[model samples]
Target: MAPQSNKQWTVNGTSGFDALKFNENAPIPKLGDKDVLVRFHGASLNYRDLIIPKGQYPFPQRDGVVPASDGSGTVEEVGGQVTRFKKGDEVVTLFNQGHLGGSLNPTINETGVGGVIDGTLRQYGKFDEQGLVKKPKNLNFLEASTLSCAGLTAWNGLYGLESRALKQGDWVLTQGTGGVSIFALQFAKSAGATVIATTSSAAKAETLKKLGADHVINYKEDTNWGETARKLTPDQLGVHHVLEVGGPTTMAQSLKAIKIDGVISIIGFLGGVKGDQPTFLDCLTNICTVRGVLVGSRLMFEDMNRAVEANNIKPVVDEKVFSLEEVREAYEYMWAQKHFGKLCIRID
Candidate 1:
């Protein structure tokens, strides 16, 4: 039976984590002809989830929007016309519902969940049949929750480029141990590519190595860690793919770390907005392609799930699982960068 009311976290008319007001009686919308009613079991956090409530995200966020894009759930009820999913199937949310395949554009960007529309920080959500994909058979809901954003972004960065996709023996450079970087490290290794990861602490470096990073560079000790990473590659030509998440502060080094005609997937700006930033001249000097990545299409998400299942790539989630009421605490923890891998919320 469809639930009479939904329990959820909504963006109250305020800023910051304090704005996440929990409502136990929000109405569950009626399903459209092609819609399915989902009972979410888990949801994961991303950097954007922190900034969106604070009015810091660049996208157009709706008033009172449910505030998480990554969620895993079971189809509890399906509309009569829905064909892709049945009532008992396990599914994961698609970050951009309209993006089925091909390159991203404004239309697809506007379809971003948790921003332009209501999202999954709730017990029940109604989605078009196309908005969710089947979860990997080997992964439970918690592990699958990490995929919609971070996992897919990493997959897109590594394999979205048809002509320059990650290949066997290629060297991949990943920054820090954030969700995307960790996924990149794991995915690259699965594809038989060598991975060089960067982190500030020795403890994290050890963790990175255990995750299959061929070499872990301590950027604090070796300020020129990019050059260090480059030299580790054959003939010192530099890494084939650079996951550039650090933005302004790290771009210069990323330039130094790339080979001629290499690819730098610009993923985020976690390293502060103000800094001595690199310019286009540096890109010319490095002779690399800097592509801005904003998650990926649903097709790519499906492809990534296949890879995750085939390679048994379990996502690294933090040990402390937060309850729905603890969403604010989860946000604060992510803001402090205190947790390793992805932080998730149990939707029960």
Candidate 2:
């Protein structure tokens, strides 16, 4: 492929809430040592994308910083010393730009791809080759786009802790049918752990079952849904793990549902930020552990792709592909939460 100019969305400073406008003046970024220039095929929207436009998360110093954390594309160019990826390689950019391996560090945590740095919602994106992972062969660009952030969050939340042990025949609980929870369901089932999933809609219960949920709970019908969760686990030991995406409001219920010495992975704040905090008595009674999860590293991304390839699992994507010009509509659709899976944008 020939070298080409870049096209991107620009958020005008005055109207922070306004839609991003196309800007031709944006310069195509130059590839540095160990860098790869990717011509993005598709990108996925996330809650973070909504936060950035409202200035909840400020953009980095780079001009015209596009706002999407996850995407997949074909490598268009690579700089000298780039070994892991090459031109024409299909890859996904890790959300954390340079955090490749080892334990998380403050330095590595400072920068991310889509927030505080230029993101993937563009016709082209550039990053260090270390930040890219080969897209799983089973996934198309749109499906792979959801993996970098959401998929990795689920993986890291379930497996990241050094102490928590998730074994075959164990039971895990996931709240809602959001991206992370859905990924957790698939991963837990693949690992031989039975999954109990929760959904607000009874209609979505069948879909959750189809995704391999061992038991599905309509949280709306059962106000005491935690008890329902306990009944689903083997020997009534309660679930071995809980993907705690519901934050404070549901934390107590999650604690109630987990078995003694169970692990709770805290990944989101969907269920309001303020509530009656859990007491030490509750912790002592349940012997539960809660771990905070940030989106994972590039190394985790590679491992996830390996698992995806090995299992031949395909991500569920309820996509509404929009041209670059219809970016605002795409954002609106995601905000409405009407879609069953990820919403994608076509960069071409």
Candidate number of the best TM-score: 1
The residue-level lDDT of candidate 1 at 213 comes to: 94
In candidate 1, what are the lDDT values of residues 41-149, reduced to their tens digit?
9999999988888877887678788989999999999898999999899999999989999987888788888887688889999888998999999999999999999
> Relative to the unseen true structure, what is the C-alpha lDDT of residue 297 in candidate 1, on a scale of 0 to 100?
92
Model 1 CA deviation exceeding 4 Å by range: none
Model 2 regions lying over 4 Å from their true place:
11-19, 57-64, 279-281
Model 2: per-residue Cα lDDT over 115-161, one tens digit each: 65678878888888878889999998988988988899999977787
Q: What residue pairs clash in candidate 1, if any at all?
A: none
lDDT score, candidate 1, position 265? 96
| Residue 213 in model 2: lDDT | 91
Look at candidate 2 and give me any clashing residue pairs: none
Compute the lDDT of residue 286 as modeled in candidate 2: 85
